[model samples]
Target: MYSNTSELAEDKLLLLYLLDKIKLPISNNKVTEIILENNFINYFTLQQYLTELANANFINYIEQEGKHRIIVSNKGLKVLSLFRNRISEVKIKAIDCYLKKQMESIKKEIAISADYTIEGNNYIVNLKAVENNSILIDLKLNVASNKQAKDLCAKWKKNSSKLYNELFKVLINN
Candidate 1:
């Protein structure tokens, strides 16, 4: 219930993910396998985090099949959206705004619906520590070999020609 703990945020994410995986209140084997596959944490370390999670009341259960059979408490799922928004490497809203302007020239895809998230490189911009810079720019832009990304950048930069040339130059060179 307490969200103030440092581990609570990450623990909350794990709880939600695990709960989704074992929707039927599974035993330890199934839960542990899912956690390992997702790379939430290594086996040894997860044990420690699990204790913290129990203390935080995100998830609590007995160990079965040599692993923890976890479930997401209501208090746990409550923090998921907050953690997702806070820890996300890319801010979805900013990317949507930037991509909306840049990709206008390209074929539209669903017009930025609510589910749009920074799940992949195509729609993602590593926004961690990204401050005091143009909205659309990111290090991942360097890996874009496709015309869509290039053209989108060009269109955006072209639109802002008088205000700044740095963005336009990047698009032009690409």
Candidate 2:
């Protein structure tokens, strides 16, 4: 049985290890999904540790194009080198397998973009679908409410593939 404090430490280390493996900055949402899959930490605690890591200089966050990406710092690398064994080999393998399976999907999710900005008296929601670092769809729609904008963003992220296929079908059929 692991103590609560020890579990938190493990969670932090696991996160660092994951970032190291990917060797690229990933969004907090991606990290949250991976960690939640393993049931290592709850969502709120995961958010707390992400903040703690950034504050401790163990990790840094880069905000580009209105999205945040998390990268491990040199200090974090050194710490992982020192204490990575605190995480079991089993957990390590699990992370490795998870990333191998989900990395592409995660990248796709990152590539699909959605955001809303207020313009004069309306909310303009911008949605995009990208593939191979190329823009496949760039759409802007004016919506009536903040809630509608938020919902559209969520729906776009969730159903982007379906949307893309349907769009192509419509364009080709016409």
Candidate 3:
């Protein structure tokens, strides 16, 4: 989508720099949200850049728990180190500030997750909590209706930590 070679290269470097700063595997949706929210690049252009970066071994895309996640490759870090100056200091500072403000929400987004699927006459809800890339809790429930499943997921997202602590207390007391 970019007509200028330098611009394309610089944008790719910008992405790499972002991933390096994150230092964690990020879901595709999260990456898209950040880039689009910042108005750094259009959706189609971002897709193309992601594909090119993955193909060139500059970024690694992996599927886990049915989600697509991306992380910067070692080669990408090297490239960023060499070309990061192409990205303006203003852009870098903006990213740093934004990350600082949103890192907690981002971590919660990555760590707490819930989803549902229809199974026969029931809805199967899956709720999970993760820390440091390790599973802290994984719970599945079979509900009679979609509304029940949705409510369960919402509650799980909001109260998973409290529930986990309570569950732990109950189990230990027994």
Candidate 4:
């Protein structure tokens, strides 16, 4: 939606600013959701900006499990510090407000995950707990039925922390 060169630069700076503010590796989907939800930029434009930023080393992509997560680089932080004011104050405040409201949900989304796939005659369930871009636990199990796999995945998402604690306790105490 931006038609001017300055506007283009501003948009790119905005993206960098947002990524720097997040301070955590975030999924592409969540980044898209945040930018689109705020009507900051169009989807295609956002994608283009992201690619440019990555290409310029302003952002870095990490492949965790099967998902690509984005984080701001040190170079990006320096750039943001130098040109952050290119983004309007209104937009900056808006981004901060949105993050304040959504941070908890965002952290939750990044912390625990579960998925299942069929393999031969059984189902393979993968459960994980992640913190600060590190894997706290990666547990895989084989279940006999689709229903069981689904149930386990759902439970893992909801109770991974408790389950992990109990598992650690048992393993260490035994």
Candidate 5:
């Protein structure tokens, strides 16, 4: 249970602090996961703070190929630099621990993405794989139905690495 004013302040600072440490454009889902895992704040409060931070120009929300990601703005970095110490060291350590454990899963999610859109009678599915700032794969396929598009996306999420490997093998052997 948190009081209104102090709780809001702490929640905002904690969100900023987590973003600063992660140092990457992360999805709202990922941020929610970390906050919930820590159990410091409720989900509703976290969403409120995230909105407030973005509204204040402390963070920017970007949609890339249909994925929503948030990054700290220059203003955010400055604010964090000045006030990050206000957050307790214990909290910082806890965030660090959580990030360390979950980084691989985070990377896995960010590395591959799938999206679909309807064009006339068909669905166009766009599947992508990125590492660092480089695009490793950009594939688009036309499917007959929305269900097919959706199933393709689910399979892509699960079997992207294997698919990529097979693709590379065929390309190289040809």
Candidate 6:
């Protein structure tokens, strides 16, 4: 879990690139070709990005015969989204003093298996890990809302997910 970041990054690039492409689970060469044709990023740098995404347990784009493919499983979307929101919020630091105790309390009540500390430019947080088999149910008290986070989680599924996911699925199914 701690080392899947690189591969997860790669997956993101592949997914993002192939999102509206000929669908995923295509040929291995197709993935490489897509990477090359994009040319927005070079080989080594791109590889590193892929590696990062993979390490984070995102998804992997593999090539088989002559097509590219994708594998989507989990939802780190909530955690990742939270990271995005709190990323620039300096006030998050104020919760530090109570964070440790809160973490302990949460661990007792929930199935958080492991945790990681992410240090941001303005804030830091200890992300309590949820079980690999469980869906993350986040319940917060209060905060000014953008609703994007709520919307993101709702879009986790194809039918219930957002237009991007539905469109992505159509392309993949073909």
**Top model by lDDT, which number?**
4
Residue 9 Cα positional deviation in candidate 2, in Å, after optimal superposition: 3.6
Q: Write the per-residue lDDT of candidate 1 for residues 97-128, one digit (tens) a residue.
A: 43355343321111111111234465432211
lDDT of 5 by residue, 95-152 (tens): 9999899887787788899889999999999989888868889999999999999999
TM-score, candidate number 1: 0.37
* Model 3: CA > 4 A from native: 1-3
Write one digit per residue (lDDT tens) for candidate 2, span 75-157: 99999999998898889999999989988787777788899999988999999987665789998999999999999999999
Best by TM-score: 3
- The order by descending lDDT is 4, 3, 2, 5, 1, 6
As for candidate 1, its clashing pairs are: none
Q: What TM-score would you give candidate 6 relative to the actual structure?
A: 0.29
Worst 10 residues of 2 by lDDT: 1-10
| RMSD of each predicted structure | 17.4, 4.5, 1.6, 2.2, 2.3, 21.5
The lDDT of model 6 is 0.39
Please state the error at residue 173 of candidate 6 in Å.
32
Which residue runs of candidate 2 sit more than 4 Å off their true CA positions? 1-8, 118-125, 128-174
User: Which candidate, 1 or 2, has the higher lDDT?
Assistant: 2
Model 3, global lDDT? 0.88
lDDT scores of the candidates, listed in order? 0.46, 0.88, 0.88, 0.90, 0.86, 0.39
- At residue 18, what lDDT does model 4 achieve? 86
Ranking by TM-score: 3, 4, 5, 2, 1, 6
lDDT score at residue 155, model 1, on the 0-100 scale: 51
Error of 6 at 129 (Å): 42
Q: How many backbone collisions does model 4 have?
A: 0
